[model samples]
Target: MTEEPPIAVLTDDTAYAEAVQLAVDSAAAYYADGTSTLDDDAYDRLARGIQAYEEAHPEAVLATSPTGKVAGGAVVGDVPHTVPMLSLDNVFGAEQLADWATSLERRLGRPVAAWSVEPKLDGLAISARYRHGRLTQLVTRGDGTAGEDVSHAIGTIVGLPARLAEPVTIELRGEVLMTTEQFEVACLKRQAHDGTTFANPRSAAAGTLRAQDRPYVCELTFFGYGALPYPDDASEQAASLRELPHSEIMTWVAAQGVQTTAATPVAGIVAETLVQVQERIEQIATVRPELPFNIDGIVIKCDLAADQSQAGFGSRAPRWAIAYKLPATEKITKLIGVEWNTGRTGIIAPRAVLEPVELDGSIVTYATLHNASDIARRGLMLGDSVTVYKAGDVIPRVEAPVVHLRTGDERPIEIPQVCPSCGDGIDSSQERWRCVRGRSCRAIASITYATGRDQLDIEGLATSRIEQMLDAGLISDFADLFYLTREQVLGLERMGETSTNNLLAAIERTKAQPLSRVFCALGVRGTGRSMSRRIARHFGSMDAIRAADAEAIQAVEGIGPEKAPVVVAELVELAPLIDKLVAAGVTMTEPGWRPPAVPGIDVDPDAQTAPEAGGTSELPLAGMSVVVTGSMSGALEALTRNQMNELIERAGGKSSSSVSKKTSLLVAGENAGSKRAKAESLDVRIVGPEEFADLVGALL
Candidate 1:
């Protein structure tokens, strides 16, 4: 790779200063033409680099380093920042942070009187100004001086108040974010409408905010942080600030009618404050209900202005504060059912009904089954069981199913020869099927699945809404989500304008998602999280998947002997349907991975590898054949074990009705009888209680 001189450094040293000036000039050229001189990443990198270089070389780098001053003469036309906004210099890990804390103490000549720590919302930074408590203007954090005026956008957002409690004039800055529920729903809506998708809430919100349309911005939500007009000026004293309680301010802001982010109480010292911040972040997934929006991390600020003043400012933000982020949420669940719902695409989808499960604190009950072929090839039957999981807390799925049990009831299921919706037989082709109902039954599963922790994961679209959406016939399928006018959504008995806009904005933001996300959104059968990855890997493009023959498809990994034919049949049935989705403008594409494929397939990589050549890779579960009698619904059943041992290499665990010395994890159901006793006498490991989860995760 060609190396560019460290622009951040070069901008400071020996005559390179002149070059930095030239680049600044070039930046101005782009800024003047309604274009950005730097992409977000590059700009952030350059600005930080320049700041670092200046901080290091005082003689070579001037006091007015790029880091210290506002953007000079960039000539941005849209919105000018009334107050300069600066980015904070980050310090990672607690030790280094402690060092900084110590330094602050040395500077202060005493311990901090008090400090306030708040969550640093991961999102775009913007400022909103209100005159006499009414909204005035909205601007981005451009170069800290000039910004793109988004006053038009400010006018549309749902939560911000038109007037404050005190009728106070002020300018406030904070992160504008799409709530986790909002982001998921938006992703679902986009996947249904245009096949396009975004990576996360931040990207979804940012893209929507910057999109050309005003209605789109109105849908995205915004939150606020500290800016001006302290309800109690006395709240600023260092001693008092340490006592600066978060709940009071939050309550105060609400009363003032100003939107405020949820924050915690202030502690006496930075160390203690940081500890509190860590705890909150750790519990974020657990506390989603209380949070207004999704948070990637938190920001800690010294509540006392005196300490803040003593600490002074960094290149941009105050040294008194910093941001602490959390890791993304992930977990596993199980698939118990796949509900087939007709769509705009005549092809049917098997949406998974899961065991009551908690992932990232949210109770999950459904996943998409992908397509019909997936259902059959995976040997999935009405009674056969399967595993479920999530990629990120945002995307839940049914990864695989067990094919061993002949529950007799677990029989092969198929799409009706005639369409379920219109009861009219429609034609299918190489890549898709035609929906007899076309758009009529398309929305059948919308209220449930669409809101089922997948697409447009509406928190409250419960049992009632499913019936309501169907009764209203306001929508036929997912695409109709975007078409929903505010008036129509608000017309629903429980929904109002605020709620409707929240859902609609989520719909708009999802359109910008990269294509692969759209494919996952489809809920294809036999397409586990990993397989979706494989398909994306081999095809590398949506066109390829849509065009490949069954023979060609069986060629991919995770695409097994039985599945290949099903996959081809799946796409064939989906082709016409997808075409309709395309006409609607969905952005379907390959997933994240696009690795070159070896001809042979590698199904079930997660299954334990054989213990060397062929030494009976002894299943620790060996001799522990299990008979899951009765209701094992709450626990892993015989089917669950059969599926799990394939995961256990040695457990070579078997399922039987009668338990012997070979019985392990007896897994007695509600009516389990003699078999349970036989197993207990045989000293079999009877797995039960809530401990089932621990045993399951450890063994698997």
Candidate 2:
């Protein structure tokens, strides 16, 4: 696919005609075949250019131009709509959104009473008609005035029930789309039937909705956005619904067993002022990346029926509503090559090297392919144009190849026959290929992780120095570092007398680290810093952990049956290294760890009694779930995330990675983003890092 052209002002008739043609063609392909060369962002720019040209030269506008038509005048149907399925005008940023709000108030001749904000779901728009509380037909939004019949897809769509809770005739307007999980399932089913992979979720939903008589089926999801009285129905209830506010109408829709935006993070909400609406928009945008579905923009509509009626409608859209668009997260880029890099666990992961493309707000040059199987599933090839997606803080990934735009010059991706790091044979027993050498193949990665701040925390052991030691044969594994001599360190390059002594001292300190850090430094497959701490505390000693079987290991707080076996096997494999560390005088037991009480064991009367179930504990933050976000300051300025977690544990609180309803408190520092917004939305208590520092000051 070609890169999107820059948006330009149409200064002459030639430029104007070209822009109009591009817009019409792109829209036609999108509506008719569920595929388009231009993405939503590019198409919107082209359409905006056409609108600007027509505004400046109204007398010279052509009759066939796509200025004031739904679906860009590219789609037609025989089924007429009761009310025009109008499209929404777009605003790019806060200033434009504010200007639109001001214009709406100006047109209404008064300040608006209220506003409703919702997510603008990226999907196809359809009208579902219900007769006497039963779904009878589904129609696509073709040219707004009329639409194509798609009622044949009734049973396959989720959220659009065949029977309603009430026996009333009405028309429901909503978007039909596939969620992230649903889209993946659909792709696998389509590929099983020898169909080409879908370019994106929006197109997959579009194709699945219109499909007929296929041997397989792909599920679709729906969320109602509007409700109106059926053209043929003259019921009193229908008339009364039209008089109600937009927010109340949506609530009624949800009560009738129809799915609305009530369950989503960006649920429809009523705001009494423009400031509240803007804040809601910002909140939605902040959590956009974490949502399970795709949303291109936030829709802001006047809530009061009286306000909507007074504002009236334009030729294309209602003046009462506008869409505030966000920057596009998906962009077309060329797959230049593939690079296979072995992970710390010896799994060979494939990464896609792409032509630099601007996605979201940054330039992306690489994307994750997950593994060799993922590349095969996507049918990706070198030199092919691919859709790369990047959200906030999410690693960029290759969605799929644009098969329609592929040329014969594209070549098949080559899978590596040997391990990239160790030049050894690959074990292909599982879907993800691994090296026969296992952790031995990735010595550098494993060693570096073992010495990280959250693990053993051996100071002055940077990756470069570790590599130098390995090159000189002074260290074969992390356990060997504790046995190095001063003469051996001084033999390496840049190792002066004082530097050697400091490095030796750092290595000496690691010998006294508790068993929890030592086990964490072992680089077990199924265990991380947190799990390592849990395991060491539960078993109390490394010998007991190694002696425990899979069944006994399952008793650890987070370990399950499947994971328990994996941890047991990894510990067995690392037995030799563990014995070496023990001989080197490393601490074998966790500090302050105690064995759990047995059911019938005799206990010492002098020992401290356990806290009662409903009683408060002595710890300041006992039983609380705490989340820390953003940058810390003041007394907590220098604490790392792992150190913060340690502090939370010391204060008897459970450190959580995310903020949800279960979260008791959030430590929000400067520039906190999505987690802070979610905490506020869920009504979870929030405080600054300084306050958090004070709360846990005793433990510190």
Error of 1 at 390 (Å): 12
Residues 1-700, model 1: lDDT tens digits: 0112123445437544753564475455333322233322244446656656666776676543455554433545456665567666444345555666677778778877655655566566778777767888777776776777767666555457767666556666766777757766666565555444444455567666666642232266666665644333433332342344433444555566655654322111233554554444333323332354655445666666667777887656667766543333322333455565566434655577777665433567887666665554344555545444343334576544432223456555556566666677655543245565544445554335534443334444465655676689876555555566788778888888777777767666665443434554455555643355446545656787878887888887557787787767667755655665676665555322233435896645333233322233333444445555555554354334323323332233444544444445776557665455455434677765334434445443
Residue 97 shift from truth in candidate 1, angstroms: 1.9
Model 2 lDDT tens row, 263-366: 98789899998888878887888778878899998899999899998899999899999988888889888999999999887888899999998787778999
Question: What are the lDDT scores of the predictions, listed in order?
Answer: 0.54, 0.86
Stretches off by above 4 angstroms in model 1 are 1-65, 69-84, 145-149, 179-218, 230-247, 263-273, 281-296, 325-700
Error of 1 at 167 (Å): 3.5
TM-scores, each model vs. reference: 0.41, 0.93
lDDT of 2: 0.86
Pairs of residues at least 3 apart in sequence or in different chains that clash in candidate 2: none
Q: Which lDDT value does model 1 have at 465?
A: 55
